[model samples]
Each structure stands twice: as structure tokens, then as C-alpha cells.
Target: MEFTAEIDIMPLDALLDPQGKAVSGSMKNLGLSEITNVRIGKHITLKVKAKDKSEAEAKVDEACKKLLANQIMEKYSFSLKELVA
Candidate 1:
């Protein structure tokens, strides 16, 4: 079976995000003051081949823990969808 993993990686709430703050400041300069406390993150999409949903999920989680996300500074979450055909 083939699965699609959609992952989101973000800095922990306790951490400061300079890029997001920069963007937020720019937004205010552009007259979008209502938008504040912006935090930037990463989104990743990948396809995994496995025998079943559980196997695919495990693989995706392992990938996230081992390489995709930094456990110390960032947290990651993912959702898997089975691909048809």
C-alpha cells in the first residue's frame, strides 16, 4: 500500500521564532496590525510504501523522530492518507 504523509513542524511554544516575528512586524507595517504573534513553521509531504496502514504510520513517525523534526526545539505532527490506485 501507498500512503501520503502530511507533516507540520513548528518551534515549541517556549522557543522564540525570529522569522515569524519578522513577518509579523512586516504585517503591521503593511497595515495588518490585527495579525500578531506569528510563528513560522515547515510543512512536508512524502509518500511511503508499506504493507498496511499501521506499518506506514510507524514509518512516518520514525522518520519524523529521527530526521524530520528536532525534538528539542521543534515538535512535529503528521497525518497519513492511503492513496488509491
Candidate 2:
């Protein structure tokens, strides 16, 4: 079976995001003061070959923990879907 994983990695809410703050400040300069507390995160999409949905989920979780996300500062969430062709 083939599966597709859609992952999102973001800084922990307890931590400050300098880039997000900078963008939030810029929003006012652009006369978009309504947009505040801007946050930036990363989205990743990948395809995997697995024996089943559970296998695919485990693989994606392992990938995020081992390589994709920094568990100390960032948190990750992913959704998996089977690929039909």
C-alpha cells in the first residue's frame, strides 16, 4: 500500500517566535494592523510505501521524531491517507 503524509511542524507555543513577531510588526506597517500574532510553521508532504495504514502511520511518526522535527523546540502533527491509483 502507498500512503501520503501531510505534516506540520511548529515552534512550541510557550516559546517566542522571532520571525513571527517580525512579520506581525510588519503587518502594521502595511496597514494591516488587524493581523497580529502571526505565526510561521513548516508543512511537509511525502509518499511512503507500507504494508498497511498502521505501518504508514508509524513510519511517518518515526520520521518526524528522528529527522523532520526538533522535539525539544518544535512539535509535529501529521495526517496520513492511502494513495489510490
Candidate 3:
């Protein structure tokens, strides 16, 4: 079976995101004062071939932990869906 994984990786809440802060600050300059505390993160999409949903999920998790995300400063979450057709 083929599965699609949608992953989101973000800096830990305890850590300050400089890029997000910069963008948030710019929002005010653009006359959008209502927008605040903006956070920047990464979204990754990939396809995995596995025998079943459980196996696909495991592969996605492994990829996130071992390659996609820096476990020390960033956290990640992923959802898997079976691809039809």
C-alpha cells in the first residue's frame, strides 16, 4: 500500500522563534495589528510504501525523528492517509 504523510515540524514552545517574531513585527507595519504571536514552522509531504497503515505510520515517525526534525530544538507530528487510485 502507498500512503501520504503530512508532517509539521516546529520549534519548541519554550524556544523563541526569531523568524516568526520578525514576521509578526512586520504585520503591524502592514497595518495588521490584530495579527500577533505568529509562529513559523515547516510542513513536509512525502509518500511511503508499506504493507499497512501501521507500518506506514511507523516509517513516517522514524523519518521525522531520524531525518526531518531536530529532536533537540524542534518537535514534529504527522498524519498518514492511504492513497487511492
Alpha-carbon RMSD to native, per candidate: 0.7, 0.9, 0.7
Model 2 residue 66 lDDT score: 99
What digit string (tens of lDDT, one per residue) describes model 1 on residues 1-85?
9999999999999999999999999997899999999999999999999999999999999999999999999999999999999
Models 1 onward score TM values of 0.95, 0.94, 0.95
Across residues 1-85, which tens digit of lDDT does each residue of candidate 3 receive?
Answer: 9999999999999999999999999999999999999989999999999999999999999999999999999999999999997
> Which structure is stronger by lDDT: 2 or 3?
2
Off by over 4 Å in 1: none
Task: Tell me how far the alpha carbon of residue 10 in candidate 3 is from the true structure, in angstroms, after superposition.
Answer: 0.5
Residue 83 error for model 2, in Å?
Answer: 0.9
lDDT of 1: 0.96
Candidate 2: where are CA atoms >4 Å away? none
Regions of model 3 farther than 4 Å from truth: none
**Model 2: colliding residue pairs:** none
| Candidate 3 residue pairs in backbone clash | none
